[model samples]
Target: MASRKAITRSQAVKYRDASKAGKAAILDLVCAVTGFNRDYARRALRQALVPRVV
Candidate 1:
């Protein structure tokens, strides 16, 4: 079997931008596409959505 690829920061950023839907949908899509668990995807998406402190 092929190895699973990890989601990159850029991809997470893109996912954050693409999540125009509600949080549930965003989490669903993230988990579905990345094959990440629900909790992990939620955390990643949440982190990506947060504004960075300069």
Candidate 2:
């Protein structure tokens, strides 16, 4: 979802700039709410997300 990506990207700044504990907290919240894959979330937050080609 583009909206999801937009939301994630906005939060990406926080995620990328966050402290260790903050990053973990954000990841936990995101995962809990969106059921996003941890690894994928990590990538997205790093601005490394690419659309799936399936």
Best by lDDT: 2
- Candidates' C-alpha lDDT: 0.61, 0.75
For candidate 2, what is the TM-score? 0.73
For residues 1-54, what per-residue lDDT tens digits would candidate 1 score against the true structure?
A: 022234434456666566456556756765777788988876776675567899
lDDT of 2 by residue, 1-54 (tens): 786677687777788778999999988777766668988777777863444577
Rate residue 38 of model 1 by lDDT: 84
Q: Estimated TM-score per prediction?
A: 0.50, 0.73
**Candidate 2 weakest lDDT stretch, 10 residues:** 44-53
Model 1, runs deviating above 4 Å: 1-21, 50-54
Clashes of each: 0, 0
